[model samples]
Target: MNKSRIFRTLLGIAIVSAVPTLAHAQKANWQNLDLKSDSTFGISTEKAYKELLKGKKSVKVIVAVNDGGVEATHEDLKRIMWVNTKEKPGNGKDDDKNGYIDDINGWNFIGGPKESVNFETLELTRLVRRDQARFANTTDANVAEKDKKDFEAFKAERAELEQKLAEAKENLAGITGFKTALDAVVQKIGKENPTAEDFKNFKPSTAIEGRIQGILIQQLEKGSFKDFYEDQIKEGLDYYTRQAEYNLNLDYDPRSIVGDDPNNDKERFYGNNDVAGPDAMHGTHVAGIIAADRTNKIGILGVADNVAIMGVRCTPNGDERDKDVANAIRYAVDNGAKVINMSFGKAYSWNKAVVNEAMKYAASKDVLIVQAAGNENKNIDVENNFPNHKDLDEKTIASWITVGASGPKDDETLKASFSNYGKNQVDVFAPGVQIYSTVPGSKYKSLDGTSMASPVVAGLAGLIRSYYPKLTAAQVKEIIVKSVTKVNHNVEYAKGEGPDAEKVSVPFSDLCISGGIVNAYNALKLAATYSGKSVAK
Candidate 1:
């Protein structure tokens, strides 16, 4: 997830992207299945329809996908897109005078008149660069009183930056060396593009040669793209290289392409209306999870019934700016989005106050914000995960939900291996493993992350709001939390940091506040009792 928060997941090299692999024409809706009959820990969506909502009616509910970007015109998404009614399409003028021209779909906070800012420096990298000029020449003794705290942060960031840079370079060397050896094996086989059969049948002279053949055979057998050299590993090479070159580079900056005043955080009306910005894979999948065309019967069915997806692009290839996130939330709320799915979070925040104020604004307007608990396996209670609900004093926000990833297993693997968990910070868990949903270009594939889980909950929230119009955002959150199907088993938990952390057995209830996977059937029943409204909107 986190097209906003990408990190290491590679063979031995620490790759920067958690790119979801392609699912070879998979049509299984395991996320919407039943636990008893299907043996899958799904949301009981199919059961909800047959048992409770068979003849019910629902009103339109707008669920804003505040993520990297979305394919608004995909075959499964075009019908349910949020169209800006007041603004005219293609006139080049702000017909609604909302400062964004021709915003027929939604606004893109990372875009400008001619282009969009695709990749940006992480908040850590930005901090290092911004403070390098003043702190590079000073030390603990010479730094001023007010600047002491900032100087300490700068030192920490600089050190972390150096370590990560070294690791990246080392990892890149390993990948390149592997490819060089792979080429040697291919040359010996006399095949330009070696197949599984070629690698399996060929005889190796040395032990190192046998190791290379074994690795290639394993990669090709994953059933992903067969060309491991060109498709899978090559993509990893390019991604990690770009991450090292741009995300970790202090000299590279893409903000100038957006034509914004760099010093100001108060500037709100800067980005253009390119809602589906450069890369739409991540956000498009999130949007499809909420509500693709369920009636079409051609592709897969979505989670909610009457959801209109509003794409508010903000997240980039690297960390998203706090200013963009704050503006994206405000834009969605002002434009009548009832539920916002923010499938992105970072390890640090440059300006939390602005985002806090925007969250408050959404709360004041009755817009519920759903966020991911990040992909790091560490407990967020000890580590930092931004865009959380707690204010400066640790007081919780009423209408916010922080989700963790749950899988199809019933035992130790119930929680996704890489999901971040917290009993206080994370609110609930949902299906996030091998989740089949829409990607770009009318295509479908299975992806993983709390990014996918968040939209499932958001879609449920939208469904509840659509059917029970009398329910408040806070009430919907309460019902969802209270109605989860609790887990009664202990699961393996990573007790510490680093790769070789000890695995301890802990009750699944201790992972998150809800202690279970979300159940849409139970939540709808709870909503009916709480609001004294059911079946119709």
Candidate 2:
């Protein structure tokens, strides 16, 4: 047989019967789990909880939540939160001497201390301003060439903004319609407060009522926020309205609302201590995921029971500024956070140096930063995502782990269709599909993305750090990477849509550097070796 035929034969054999190495068999046992079962074993979660908390020792590992502000007082989260006792509430003094006054937990970069801003629109405004100044019909060849490129980029952004605004408007209209129908139904059947069972019993006459039922069901799935739809609905309506108006408009500038010269990267000492900004949904949800009190049986269990979720609100409904992300990482590391979870990212970054500098600083402090790979599902090695450590040099600076989304189906096809991937860019994959975790205002919701995946890994990182406090950041990274289960399964890719059916399965080697899926149980077992400690059970 020729070489090509021999290779084909080998490939066929490999696909037909998996090459079961010892590690593969161990991982295979984990893959056999019935994901639909209530007591379904999450190898990572179970192992971490058991090994890391053997004696139930109180280990407070702070995980900085850098996207949005978290709800500090959720029923399941209140007990585990890290409160800044040095800074007295509403006293207007910088008691901790950490620059920001009254920072009881963390700072809100978007809202600043006094005002709010839409940072993405601010970047757009800057681009527009540059285009206007450079392209005002001077007819200089070189300058005109630069201006033309800038103008095209600006135009693309403007188009995107307009399209997003239009979509938001349509969504808001539907929400408004359903909300109107919901108000009438709740008033008639539920009086002031309505439960899921109450809404089920409530009758609907018009087509709008059916839509209202769907909306109510969605709110119910969020776990709570049923009794406060009047407040939650209004708040949501207002948020979407603002997003459509300011964030979606190419001309609008919310930077002025925050009183900072956004174009000047040097003017950084602005934002204040209002971590829980006008919108607390994403931050609160993230906080609950990392550190919600375990064994509460009230809402949901967080990944790390011993973690202190520090909410540094820097992201809005749109893109997070590089400056805010960099500063937030620095703050988290400096303030004693061992692991920082950045669940938000964008395709463009203006000042890459600022973010890179912060990443380096975090590395020096032995801090591990977990980032969301992205939601675009495109190969990231070709396209760049911001708040990343990678530069044109094609190298990551430190213990920065970029995570992709994984579905419950233990097959390559189960990967979330929107997850971004790259052999060099993304570090690993984690459970990110339809994850039931914490949200804001004492609620829980099912969200999907590498955003969810990053926290899961962060929880695992916290577990490793909790049990083996002596292990370094790099050691934890090695343990997690080495413990992952790698497979060469010929699985499905990008679900839904058509029959031409694009199916691609990466060789286990191509998915990430470690070629593995994160497993918390094995990480702890490995951490024991790294720390020179005996493996416990």
**TM-score for each of the candidates:** 0.93, 0.75
Q: Judge candidate 1 against the unseen true structure and give its global Cα lDDT, from 0 to 1.
A: 0.83
**lDDT for each of the candidates?**
0.83, 0.65
- Best-matching candidate per lDDT: 1
lDDT (tens digit, per residue) of candidate 1 on 163-273: 877877887787777667767888899977677788899899987788877766766665532334544467667766766887788898999888888568899998888
lDDT of 2: 0.65
The residue ranges of model 2 lying beyond 4 angstroms of the native Cα positions read 1-43, 51-53, 56-58, 113-126, 138-244, 295-297, 392-396, 495-509, 532-537
Report the C-alpha lDDT of model 2 over 331-412, residue by residue, as the tens digit.
Answer: 8887889999888877666788988878887888989888888876677777777765556222233477887776665555
**CA displacement after TM-score superposition, residue 401 of candidate 2 (Å):** 0.6
Name the Cα RMSD for model 1.
Answer: 3.2
